[model samples]
Target: MTRRPEQFSLNLRPGNLRSRDPDARAARDFAARDFMDGGGAPALETGRTRLLVAGMVFALAFIVIGWRLVDIAAFSPGGEPRIAATPPAPAFESGRADIVDRNGVVLATSLPTASLYANPRQVRDPAGAAARLVRALPDLSRTEIRAKLSTDRGFIWLKRNLTPREQYRVNRLGIPGLYFEREERRFYPHGRLTAHSIGFTDVDNKGLAGVERSFDAVLRGRAEPLTLSLDLRVQHVLARELAAAMTEFAAIGAAGLVMDAATGEVLAMVSLPDFDPNRPGTAAPEARFNRASLGLYEMGSVFKIFTVAMALDEGVVTLDDGYDASKPIRIARFTINDFHAKNRWLSVPEIFMYSSNIGAARMAMDTGTAVQQAFLGRLGLTRPADIELAEVGRPMVPSPWREINTVTIAYGHGLAVSPVQMASAVVAVVNGGEFRPATLIKHAEGERPAGTRIMSRDTSLKMRRLLRLVVRRGTGRQADAEGYRVGGKTGTADKLIGGRYARDARIASFAAAFPINDPRYVIFVMVDEPKGIARTHGYATGGWVAAPIVRRVVERIGPILGVEPVRDGAHEDGGEELLVRAKARASKVATN
Candidate 1:
């Protein structure tokens, strides 16, 4: 109705009145305003609520990030997130000290080396890697390397003791799984010259032979570097001379030693046909034998020294004592004859100078078995040398001490001792009657160990004079150096094989001491199965073969040992006057 009135009263239709109604118009306007305000507020509130929820989510996320940072910084084992530290490299085992000569020349030393190994777990292309490795190390079999690499095992050794160049080349390949372990390899610098004394070590650096084996514990950190008593210069000279002799005489073998009589220190010891300690595995058993200390033999006339010393020490005979040497002695199917029989009565001096078996047997009979055994024991002939070596041979003494044994032993038969024993015993006789234990180690300062007294100083002096006489005029005359007053004895004994003695096979030997007045050095030379040479008058006796060796050794080493040579006087005519006087005294005794 209001809408109709507002239309200037033009519309009389009901539809027009409905359209023109004021109450209807006002209701419609109110509904439209409510819809606009109320609905819009709900939509805006929903949107604001969604934004608040998003802010909460952001705050929660930041808390979690901060907590994790705190935990990592304060609670972690590796604090403060530092760069990882490289582990320290492991150290190598400390090496043993070197063994040097008296002149400080190197004899034995250790060299650092790399040993090849493999970590099979890290291997890639196992066959190819092995092939390359085999090529680098020809000593290793290719098939073996391939098998080792292909295995499921963790570790394996490819090779050991590679040279520096080899190690470098192997490393250059940079192949996976291949690695190296540090090790020490022992070396003997002088080769075969000092093989017997210096010795050799095993693959694992353990000492196995000669001096190395004897002192293994010391070399393995139990003690310090073992300073030996060897002199390299003297050792070289001795080996060279012995080799020359061996070649010239065409002998089966040879051995020699130069020892200090005053101290029992070995200056040089050489065994012919020796092997280099650096390559000991390639040598044969015979080459490895130490003839000077391990090969015991009947030492021929050199035993006479012990016999005479025993007689004198026991007061069985005097320097003037005499025995009938008119013929060979007969005992138990054995005949003892002098090689150069005088066919007359002889005194003690003549017995030694002429090397008469009959006179020596008579002297032993006077001394008796008890005194002889005791004397030999004192002289260290019945036991191994008290040295730091395992190769020493114990003397072969007759199990039952019979009368025949005594007689044969007196003449250097039916008894066997190493040349080292002979040299040590001889040193005791000439070095003022003291039995100092032989040593390979050097003595400390101001420490001179006292030795057991085996004989009177006077006896030692008399023995020296008699030995001097022998070198001057007796069988040992060949051993005399022109200026050096040398004294020694010659010995030639039949070799024992399979319990029977071979008369043709002989062991010729000589034992000499220089500067006879005050003996300082003792030299021993032995030739095994030496053949008779034309130059030696076809004789293989010690005087012909071993004596010349001693002479050369004395001449060479005399100057080195500071022993001055002197002119030979009438008394220096080795035991000649003593022999004549002994013969005269024997004649007089026989006449009585």
Candidate 2:
């Protein structure tokens, strides 16, 4: 039978090599040689070897891929399998401690938030994704976001601290490569009400200003909430009064402080034009300045408090002593005259009650410069206030210690002190001679820190009488709270701008204490650059602008603090007659 092509094809297998054609004979010869060498056809064996090698490579690759998946799922660094869409849960509480007022009102705390992030490499449409992102976050710039997404980076932060609504809106967009990371953000519930005291934190919860900056490490390390001496109720009353006064007087700014006379605990501290701690970045630098603690000003007649106190304590002058304030004193191109001038010889009490600058200068000269400086240093006025806030102002004192400087400083010029420093010093003068460092920390179980003696108890008692005389009949008459026995002094200083005192730009302030027979609290209010209004009789003096705020604040907070109101003649001291005689003398001098 003739051999068919199919027969030739079937005989082409290994070991079946018999053929008649010359090409087939050559193939058969090669097969026979391969068989003799104990192997298959050379080309076929080579092809099979390559196929086995390729199969092994594919198997090894698949095994490696499976092992990697297993490792990522069970042995990842975060100890959890990371899904592309959902991230791990955040801690319920923030690492930073909470800040609470005296009555346990939350001033500052942290809240959980979802921060938006993205994987740029996985983003299919960078431009489209960024455009959609802007809809959910209008504050974000589309151009900047697009540039961030178009990069080959594996991870990127789109936005941080997204609100619940914002996070939900972003999730609804269903954009690929977008993710959320749980984070804790600092939240100030009271907003601008306690901004200058509580301060604010950065995006990463780092403290930036105020008490937040002063106690940053403590807040981060401790678990218990920080208890501030601030009484939220007192804070509200003080801030409300300051704001109303600022608005009514059209003042550029305002600052006020209320402190416990016995313990030096700060009940309320306010700095106006304040920013909301939650959005501090949006506020102006001027607003962020802590005027209560950071601003230094020549405190005008208020400094007479210290001058008279110094003179009395040093035996340089007594309440019975007298000074010639009839004419302005001209010394070295500087003239010293009283704002509410009584152009006559006045007693020490008359000088304090009338806020006579010329009288104060003469009295301070009698006390001498070295004695005045040492007395102020003892009262903590010549240095930065020792408070819990980081923004404490260093007092600006006259460098040369000249006689002219002493005279000017006596009437609250040639020297500058912060409102906080003034408040603390006043506390020492009125609190039975004990000088305690001002603090924002709440005392434990009603216990207070021991105070250093800065003045004699007799001197403190005498100063209290003089302060009462001013509020009762003199320039600080507006600061008198009925039945509260408010005692205070008024201050109006020309603001020094570019080495010149501007007449219109003035720091009008009132410093007061209540129930002068037995002191309890001290309040200091200062209005910056106050403009005279019609209601104020075209006067932006401390008597017109700041004294009334002290009155209202004391009136409102007296009841809250459980301080019993004194009926007339209920709590009288023997010195009332002395003050009455002093006032009579001042009036007699004024009318002459």
Candidate 3:
């Protein structure tokens, strides 16, 4: 019942409503009759009406023919089009989220990029296209490009992760077969500075090392950056000092670690001979080795700190206990001697200060092997460090628990551990005997986690005093950062090369804590195969080479960490007179 009297629209039709010929012819009959017969046109419109009608019919037929031809061309009875230029769906959009240091400094991030692909079948001239592409991207192999273009595959990758300029140049070439698909390139803002910590990604942006590999799941499709406990400023300082020490001592490699003694959070970790994460593919294997956490070594006398702590904790030894270090002990084929041997009997503090290997071995013998191994296991040294890095070294302990093994391990030989392990163990020694699992993530302020107590609080306090005493008058004297109350041990051991210990090759290391009275940080540094230098008086020992590096690090980082210099303070036992005497003696020795 609906009325259909309205004019229909016609586009380019011969007899449309707007056509002059149609209007004139249709209204002529009415026009001649007069104004009484409704609206009309002028009367002279004659044969034009028939001509317009015929023309409209012919035009409609032509349109139908043209439409049919296009349909046949599109649907092709032969098969699908060979030159179909539809590109593959992208693998990632926006890519993985950013990675940042604890201070919100960007370490690793993603950048929008263009990748070129080719439809070989569509390439009219493979050789010419390949040549043009080579001109645009000289690094690309010309033979590979030509071979890929000649394939006749539906699609193939020509180049990946192209720069904006490169993409523009290639696009300007306007080769028919070439196409660009949007992608993202993984980038490191600091490049090699955080290479071992932030790690690098593959062409697909999948993490392969360091924190990037450990937290890949958290990063994928995540908008928020994954924040780590590392401070870039601290990392820079650590790296710079380690690099300088490596060059100064002519070391093959070096490692350094700075840890929060209270919270177990790693502030900074540096491994020399590091690679640029952005160009990891071209770096040497040695350069890629992460010495701080991934490489384990017999860390020499640094282990003495643990041995002494365990002895004091188990009541096997006391601060006043004395041991004879006048001569080396001959056990089996091994001779245990001290680098700085004291001719007479030495108290526990003197033995620690002088780094007497014989005294440390004797202390371990008294503590017993079973108890020593158990204590080390408790410190997480027998196993891999519980840090976030995927690359971690497993400690090398003796296969059979023997008496000699115990003694050698007491002075940090026979058993090899990573720098991180030594640093963490030292943290426990100074942090009121609490065993905190080292972490790469930050903990909230005043939200300290209760850790397992490995040693008595009384024993920890005594150990702190002994460490301070060593730094004050012992082999660790060079490690003293004035007013910082530096306290730690200097460890020197021969590197085992081939099948036997290499006497010429040694690992010199220093493990230290600052403001020993109220411990806040634990630092460890190791220089591998450092050749003796003239400035060090031809000594490759820890005290001479590694200790100074630790001193510099402490001095540089103290103010930044809000730890001001407290030059004057009495010992726990209130030995003000003895403290003044030691300072006077140190000043005299420095002047001499």
Candidate 4:
């Protein structure tokens, strides 16, 4: 019946009758529209488009999160961070104990610094990043940075150290793959002034030279500052004066030291052509050499000090003894003559004051080679200096000791010794004959190490008198500092090059002590290969070049070291009259 009467429902009595139930009519119309041919296609297409759009949005969010995680976890410039299942990197020496002078003035210390590095494999725009990096660090070469960044290496160092301000500037660039390592860099507060004595370290903070190396383990372990015997005031004074002398004389290099006569504590040591310890790797080999203790030279008449000391200590010669200086001594075609000959018999004081080569040779012979060698060994001269340095020069004394060696060595030729040895020996001669091992460490009160006696008090007294006489009236006349009572000897030696003495090259030196009535410090200054200056009257001798440096140093440091001048002399001391007696003896010999 339904099939026969399908149109029965279409009995349109009136459209208004169906409109009476508008809600139901609407639903029926909707159902009919869904069943119409080709109507379902648009609905299916709309649903699929909406679903695809939602999925794409979620996938993009995940992709962004993953990229961010990659950047933060592996390539952040802040440094590598450990996440789950990842280990942290090893730590480096972030700080070291401070190195300070005796008064706690900082000489060497550590500063917090930033060092730049990069993971080249993660660098996307290597060339662009390097150019920008170089802009922040203007000293960095652009090409080198690019090459480092373009590599496939996991990490590379861009710079070892950067200032905090520079680090901030670099961080603002916001480049990828760059990182910073927190580190402690060795910093020298005085720069080139303390370079040779304090030395420097490697990039990894390992000590390489000078006191830094000798006390590396101590520094690494201690928290308190390492107090050196050096006084900054003294060091500055010595360095300034030496530098001026170097410039004035046009010297290639210079070395100087001031040591405590009693305790053997080094107060100041300077070596030049010196470079800044902060950048020691860039320094030339010549500049890095510590001439104070490392360089060996035939120290000329400075050795006369030792010869006279040896003779006095061994009782082979007395202060009243005389030596013939009539002519140069000739041995095996090598002639030894005084620069200024007296051509007469001279007393011991006259020999030293005149720096007579023939007298020195005769004195050394009287002491004999065997006793001379033993005496020097006792004074720590036949071996390396006892100071705490890796660069100590072993004394070049002749082997199979012969008479010729003795004669030549007496006048300060044939044997080569370090200035440290020369200075220490002078210390023994002047400081009541006590031979204390030289040290860079500051000793506590009563904690000074025991010293061996190298000479008699009588001999030491004579040495003091003679040294004063030399500075007062002889070759070291220029070394006198008013009120300080500077007593020293001038030394000049021809530089040996290619096994022959160079005509125009010389080592000019002055070894001195101040306040000779009561000694406190010993100073030794040496100028290497000094050329004569016009102001110096065309003479590069120690009297002309090195003695003035000593005078200036003493004058400047005397007040600083609490050494008061005795302006109102009681006039009771006639020790200097001994020089007059020595001259009288020479005159007596001449009259005879």
TM-scores for all predictions: 0.77, 0.78, 0.76, 0.78
Candidate 1 lDDT over 458-575, as tens digits, reads 8888788777766776788888887888888889899998888897799999988888888989888899988888998789888888998899888888888788778556344455
lDDT of 3 by residue, 80-145 (tens): 677988799865456698888888999888999888999999999999989988998999999999
Residue runs of model 1 more than 4 Å from their true location after superposition:
1-95, 117-159, 168-179, 567-580, 583-592
User: Which is better, 3 or 4, measured by TM-score?
Assistant: 4
- Quote the lDDT for 479 in model 4: 93
In model 4, the runs with Cα more than 4 Å from the true position are 1-95, 117-136, 140-158, 171-178, 568-576
| Per-residue lDDT value at 535 in model 3 | 92
Which of the two, 2 or 4, has more lDDT?
2
The candidate that achieves the highest TM-score relative to the unseen native structure: 4
Better of 1 and 2 by lDDT: 2
Model 4 TM-score relative to the real fold: 0.78
Off by over 4 Å in 3: 1-93, 117-159, 165-178, 567-592
> Worst ten-residue run, lDDT, model 3?
1-10
Taking all chains together, the TM-score of candidate 2 against the true structure is 0.78
Q: Could you give candidate 2's per-residue lDDT for residues 90-162 as a string of tens digits?
A: 6455779999999999999988899999999999999999999998899999999999999999999999889
lDDT of 4 by residue, 57-113 (tens): 999999999999998878889754455555668654445788999999999998889
Query: By how many angstroms RMSD does model 1 differ from the true structure?
Result: 12.9
Predicted structure with the largest lDDT when compared to the true one? 2
